[model samples]
Target: MKLREIAHSRTGDKGNISNISLIAYDMNDYEKLKQAVTAEKVKAYFSDIVKGDVVRYELPNIGALNFVMYSALGGGVTRTLAHDMHGKGLSAALMNMDI
Candidate 1:
């Protein structure tokens, strides 16, 4: 099943960094999300775009996972000529991943 089936995501950006938070729709599914969504997988998923590192922070208490991707904004909002400079679409792209 796709990760979006069980969770939703929110994204934010700062300079060249992008932060995405995936929150489980049902708390019970948090564990499954944890096991399936790793820093390595996320980094690989966005390999072409994220030029730096992907760090995963587990928010078990909130039934969520936060991914901090470095160098993901093509040099921040002002510098990047990309359409999605803020990388908001990245959250949607990640949601398409199979869990």
Candidate 2:
């Protein structure tokens, strides 16, 4: 199953960083997500776009995970020639991850 089946994501971008919050639909799925979603996996998944490290922050109480991706905005919104300067599509891209 893909992560989208169990969770949804929100994306934000600032400078060259992209932040994505993955929130599970149910607490029951949190454990599965925690085990399956890792910084390394995310980094590899977006390797072509993200140029720097990926960091994951756990939010057990909320059944959510926040991923901070560095150097992902093509050198920031104002400077980048990338189509999606805000990286909004990133959330949908993440949902494509197999879980």
Candidate 3:
């Protein structure tokens, strides 16, 4: 399913990179989601599509997951098209992940 299917996103722009803050909703079922999502899990969730790295930041207080995926936007603003960069296709790709 898409990230939107499981969690809500707070998207922000920074230089060429985008920061996507994720909070799992009731739709994800906390216990199941806790077991399902992790740093390694998030990385695996994005392994193929992401070219650079996926950094995970856990928020215990909020019970949420944040991943800062880099170099996925065709070099962000540095690219010729200067495309959407900040992970243009990420939402769809992340949503497709099984877990």
Candidate 4:
């Protein structure tokens, strides 16, 4: 599945880091999404494609998940360590999940 097919992304740039926040369009999709996408799981999701650190924060109040992908070109060059292509970045990346 593509990310545009599942969720919408709200993106922000804070200095050298980029913050990508994801929310479900259909509220009913929350549980399914939560199960499929997790903090640890997200780390794996972006592990190969992203370098530095991948931090996942769960917001229970909003029933949403936020991903802080460090050194993944928020406002800087791509990570020098990993060669994986997280093409299109987070916004397009999440939509591409099989879920």
Candidate 1: the clashing residue pairs are none
Question: Tens-digit lDDT track for model 3 on 1-99?
Answer: 544666665665454455566677763354555576665776676665456666767765675767777765555656627444455456545556676
Q: After superposition, how far is residue 95 of candidate 1 from its true place, in Å?
A: 0.6
lDDT minimum window of 10 residues, candidate 1 = 80-89
For candidate 4, write residues 38-94 as lDDT tens digits.
656666776654556767777666656788877665335354343322333556666
Of 1 and 3, the candidate ahead on lDDT is 1
Cα miss at 8, model 3 (Å)?
A: 2.0
Instruction: Quote the positional error of residue 95 for candidate 2 in Å.
Output: 0.6
Whose TM-score is higher: candidate 2's or candidate 4's? Answer: 2
> Which pairs of residues have clashing backbones in candidate 4?
2-95, 3-95, 3-96
lDDT tens digits by residue: candidate 2, 1-99: 999999998889888999999999999999999999999999999999999999999999999999999999899988999787576788888899998
- For model 1, state the Cα shift of residue 88 in Å: 1.6
- TM-scores for all candidates: the values are 0.96, 0.95, 0.65, 0.67
Tell me the lDDT of model 4 at 43. 64
Best by lDDT: 1
